[model samples]
Each structure stands twice: as C-alpha cells, then as structure tokens.
Target: MSGVVEGLEGRVFTVLGAAGFVGQRVVSRLRAAGAEVFAPARGDPALWTRPLGHVVYAAGLTADYLVRPFDTVEAHVGLLARVLKEAQWESLVYLSSTRLYDSLGAVDAHEALPLRLDPGQPRHLYDLSKALGESLCHTQGQGRARVARLACVYEGAQDADGFLPSLLRQVMAAGAQPGAPRPAIEVPSSPSFERDYVHVSDVVEGLVHLALRGQHTIYNLASGENTSNASLFDGLGRRWACELRATLPAGPSEAPRIRIDRMREEFGWRPKGLHSVLDAMKETCP
Candidate 1:
C-alpha cells in the first residue's frame, strides 16, 4: 500500500528484458528504491550471468508473437528455463499475462480457472508460450517462484501499440493541431469488447510485493474492472474531443475482466484507474 518495494535496499535483483517496457519500469523502481539492480543486455547468454538476489523474468512478445513464434518461444520459455537452471536466487518472479485466459471463455475469472491453448492455432503460441513460462517458474523454482498474471499495462505516453496506448497517441496527436476537428480512433472489432487495464507503475509495485513477501505461486495483477471500447473511447471524447472509427462487423466478442481480490488480499495491492492514467498522460505527453 505504501508503493515501495519492501526491503528493497541492500538487495540484488536481476531483471531480464531490462530494456523493455515493464522491465525498464521495474529496474527504475529498483534503483529509485536503492536496490542493487542488474539489467543485462538482452539476448546475450554471457551477459545473463549475475549475482542474483531476486529475479524478475519480464521478457516476451505480444503483437508480433504470431509473426515470430520461434523468437517468442525462446524468450518466454527457453530463456526462463536457462535462468532457472543456472541462477541461485533467493526468490524469482515470472511476469505472465491475463491473455492466457482468452480461450477459456470465462469473464472475471480467477487464478483457479482452467486454461486451454489450442496448438493447431498458430496465434495461440503467445498464450501457450507464456503458460509454459509460468509452468517453468512454478515447477522449477521449487516454491521460490511467484507468477504475476498482469493485465493490459499501459504507461499512457509510450509508443507501444495497444488499445489504450493507441487511443492516447491519437488524442495527443489531435491536441497538436489547435482547433482541428476531433481526431478519430479506429476500432478493429466490436465496440462492446472490453478488458481490464492496469498502469505499469501499479504492476511494478505488485511485482515488488510478490517478490519480497508473497506466498502464493500465481496472482492476477489487474484493475479488477472491464472497460468496453465504446465506453473508453467515449470517455476519451470527453477529455480530447475524439471519435471512434469502428470498422468491424457487428457481432459478439470476448470481454475479459478479472478478479484481483487475491492480489489485494495477499499483497494489499490495487491498481490506479483510468483517470490516473489520463492525468499521467497530461504530465508526460511527448
């Protein structure tokens, strides 16, 4: 609840994918909290060697995973396997995603919900690879690994490609042209589709809490509320005078919400909502 990594000072933490979005945030927090953090350059086996006190495996792909399945597998599974096999760490936290629940057809599901990733569908590689990574941490770490199934994390001002980021970029672009007509954000699917979103900072806090004192092997780090594209874009309109250029066929789509009770009950962690995200965008707009 204090937003500080407990006992962060005088600890050595090794973070993989330290150049990435989440990894960068984690490393920044570690340094700010006075932890001895090691972030090796990604993809070099030799650089991975470090005296680890706690490990955070934050490497993997998202939108490009389908095009680069082999690389995705290597990052999500192979690298983690290599680390678990070699590292002597006090505790490890494996960063996973709530997308693993996509195929399960359950809304607001908990960690106990069963998951199935169809192998025939090549697109499922992302989800399957992440699931395999979670399995590796749970099994190999031997009670030392804690897995955080993060929701859609957006830093608001980053160049990353995701629903909220795309909207944030469009809004910021519109603000550049004074007196211009409201910019339109294209929606690729049913506007009714919704999902949970969490800020990167909140996720970092939860990750730190899990790494330091968590007893559970798996936890869902999310905002605990579903926001539909229609509702979210409408809210954006209020802030930036934007419009939705929806281009998908009208039909049903998966709406993914998740329960964060476990994360709250276990670690006293909760996410800051979209309003806070908007406030951050106003301050950090590029």
Candidate 2:
C-alpha cells in the first residue's frame, strides 16, 4: 500500500454533478493534479455522446430524498443506467452513501456486508436507488466501475447542509455576537447519536484514487471512528463558550462505525477526525 496516490497527470476525466459541493472539489482536485477534466452540467445531452476517460458519478440527492423520491431514483439509478449503456468510459466511480448501512446496527459496516432493505418503506427509497446504481455499475459496467460509499462528509464551517456543518455554523454565529449572553444552542439529535465523519478533501482524494486505481468493486471512504453528538456539543460548547442543550433523549447510534480498511490497505489513505476539523475551523473563525 503506497501512501502516494498515483500520478494523474494528463489523464482524461469526466465528473458528473460538477456543480455540487463534493463534485466541485473533485473536479478542482483532478485538474490540479493535471488531469484533463470534463464537467457537464445537469441534463447536458453531451454526457451521452462524449468519450469520458475516467468517470466520477457524484450526482445524487441526500436530505431532500424523501420529498423528491422520483428525482432521487433518477439521479441514483436512471441516469447512471443511461451512462452505463450509452457513455464510453475506461473506468467509472460512483459516489454512494454510507447511510445505506443504517439498518446494520452495532456491526462493522464494511463494503461486502449484506444490506437489508425493504422497498415498501419510503425511507428506504434512497438506499434502494443507490443500491440499484451500485448493482448496475457492477453487473453492467463490465468491471470498469467501482463504488465509493462516502461517510458523513464535512468541510470546515462553510455554509453547507448536514449535521456537523449546521452545528458549526450555529456555534460560529453565537461566537460572533460580542457582548451578547452565551446562547443555549439546542441540538436536535440525541447525545448518543454518532457518525463516522470524513473530510471532503479526503473524500475527493479517495474518489480519485478509486476512479483511477481501485481494484475492489466497493470501498468505504470514511474516518473509521465514530463521533457522538455529546462529544461534539461538549467540544463546541467549550470552544465557543456557548450553552449546550440536547433536544432528544439519548439513544443508540443510528449509524455504525464505517470500516475503511480497504481504502487504507489499497491506497494508504487516512482521513482526519471530526474534532480536528472543528478545531481548525475555530482557528479561522472571526
């Protein structure tokens, strides 16, 4: 396992969802590495006709999946199906979510773990769609596709959606108010809720590594450690000098500790912990 990611200089790459948060970073990183990158916008017909050298399929819904079930399926599977059928690519990397492991409680959430999902359940739509996408890439891609199941990804205190980013924004806003009484930031989740957060930069690196050099069909891109809400709130309360309040009762962690052994052994990739990212965000805060 080499710590060095193989040189991508002059390698042609196409990134779907290039306008998105993670997608944007992937494109930038690929270009910085001297890769010729093509970023086609959504609904661009050229995607079907272009010869995408190494494809990174980063388009998918998250928080809004419930309300946008049809779009979710389309983004996760429908478009991917077309790409697998129509587009020409030497290799492809599909960005899936580790949230698919939510039902596997207390177990090591690895890439080969058998997932239990019920299509009748509305919430499982996202999981099923992504699973189908993964399947299509595997069964139909002729071994040219790989899946990168991403964990909860965060990037400093930037304006983004998700548990960690929202919390960071709240704490930073409270800290910005000078002379105001320390406000009690109400946490919507239980203290026991935990997540394996991986930084966006690490995710971009892992995606590119998998896109170009991955040998496995699936890989978990995560920090391999869980961070509870209690730990996060305590750290934020101490760092920002704000009052911490939990709105929900303590319960079992919804997501298991994601395993990143494949990535580690294959590419020697290691992601920074959530607390460290928080601390760095604090340093840059006003």
Candidate 3:
C-alpha cells in the first residue's frame, strides 16, 4: 500500500471525529505525511473552532446509533451540516457506511443503486441519517466532496462493539491459556452469515486517497471479498492451536456486498483481505 505522500505536505486538515478509531488513523496518516492537522477530541475546547482546509468527516455511530436516535442524527447529519456551512474547506470526505445499501436487494450493491428506505421502520434511523448525510455532502459540497461508503472496518479491540472484533476478542481470550478449559465464543448470529471486512488501516488509506486525489465523488472502500464467520474462526483456530467453539444462533439473511471497482480504478488502491487482518491481529495480541 502507498504511504501518504508529499502531496498532502503543508496542507491543513480538520478531522471532525479526531478521537474516533478511523479519525485517529486518518489524523496520524495526515500528520505523518507532513500535513498540518487539527484533531479535536470529543467535547474538547476546539470542537468546531479553527478553520478547516481539507475536512474529513469521520464522526458517526454504529451499534449505539439505534439506542440514541437523536444523537445519531445530530452526529451524522447535524454536525455535518454545520461543517458544510461554517467550515472553510477545499475538499471534504464524508465517511459513510455500506449499511446504507442494506435495503437494496442487489447481490452486489453499487453506488448507482436507487436507495428506497422506509422511514417508518425504527431501525431505519441509522440508514436515514447516513442517507441524509450523503445528500448533504453531494449537494452542499458542490463537487468538492467524496462520499466513501466503507465496509465493516475491522480494528481488533478498538472496534469491540462490532461483530468481528467481539468474536476475535472472545476467541483470543479463550485461547490465551492453552490446554486449559476455554469458554465457548458465543456469536449472536449464525456462523454461515457472510460480511465484508476491511482493515482499518486500509480504510484510512482509501479515505486519504479519496480526500487528496480521487476523481469520482462516491466510492466503496472494501476488500471486495465476502467472508463467513466460520471462515474467521477457522483462521483463528489455525493460528492459536486451540479448539475454538463458537455458539451461534440463527439470524436474518446477510446483506449484499458492495462494489469496489470505482475505488480501485479511480484511486488505484486495493484493500487487503480478511485473512491479512486476522494475521495482523494475531501478531499484535499480547
């Protein structure tokens, strides 16, 4: 993967959710590339202060968005609106999710898919908020914004609330003591269920490329591979040499994967596979 280049040198960047998992990685990458960065943590003194030259809107929720609907809207749409209106930015990158493509029945959801979301559904708030955010970026940015619909970004324990992280943590903990009694890693959903997992570092790479040099306004940053839960556990079991038992319950069908050709062709970037993510986590495990 290409490291951040001198193209970003001397450029000023304002990351809204600077403290977040993705935001932090982005800030680190930008600063490492010699760009001046303003990263405000949640509720910090510089929440929305300093002018934003190149803005990366990495602020948003996932698991907690449903519980806090109003907060979700505020973070996803409200703050984004404020940035678009108040901030002085040359280019903006709005971090969106592949979850927005859930309602579309296509096996491979593309950017051109016409989204038809039912607002009456309680769970649709997350989708609705993101949809609105994308709208704001497209209409408000006036061709200066890039909308990145990220896949399930796996960052190990940093993203513990997510499915892959939770499962990885449980399996690793259970395998920590070899030859000892290990607890079953309980998966809330079925093992056969598949998902698209992109490494956080790869997501940051894609985001940075999009923010700096992408031509298309909308793109999907993903590994372009559909991996099942069973496959993930098998990957873990092969490395740990422990009997990994996961209790999985039958759940709803899986959502379709998103296309990444736009990202590949436009940005000339390809994300690493899920197995690479698993290997990285194992090497980092203490």
Name the candidate, 1 or 2, with the larger lDDT value: 2
For each candidate, give its TM-score against the true structure. 0.91, 0.95, 0.89
User: By TM-score, how accurate is candidate 1?
Assistant: 0.91
Each prediction's whole-model lDDT (CA) = 0.81, 0.87, 0.79
Off by over 4 Å in 1: 1-3, 43-50, 175-185, 279-286
Please provide, for model 3 over 1-286, each residue's C-alpha lDDT reduced to its tens digit, 9 standing for 90 to 100.
4443457788888898888888988999889988999887666655456667788999988888878988899999998898788767888999998888877754788888778788999889998999999999889987899899988887776574687777666676667465665444545556677788888888888887888887877888888888876777778777654555547764555568788888777766777788876777778884
Task: State model 1's lDDT.
Answer: 0.81
Model 3, TM vs. native: 0.89
Better of 1 and 3 by lDDT: 1
Error of 1 at 168 (Å): 1.4
Best by lDDT: 2
lDDT by residue (tens digit), candidate 1, 131-230: 9999998789889898999888887756577777877777767753567777677777677777788888889998888888888889998999887777
Name model 2 segments beyond 4 Å from true.
1-6, 176-181
- After superposition, the stretches of candidate 3 with alpha carbons farther than 4 Å from their true spots are 2-4, 41-50, 176-184, 245-253, 284-286
- Name the TM-score of candidate 2: 0.95
Clashes of 2: 0
lDDT of 2 by residue, 1-286 (tens): 1354668899999999898889999999888889899999888888878789999999999999999999999999999999999998999999998988898887899899999998899999999999999999889989889999998888866747887778878887886366778788888778998888888888988888888789989999999999888998898987897977889999766668788889988888878877887777778784
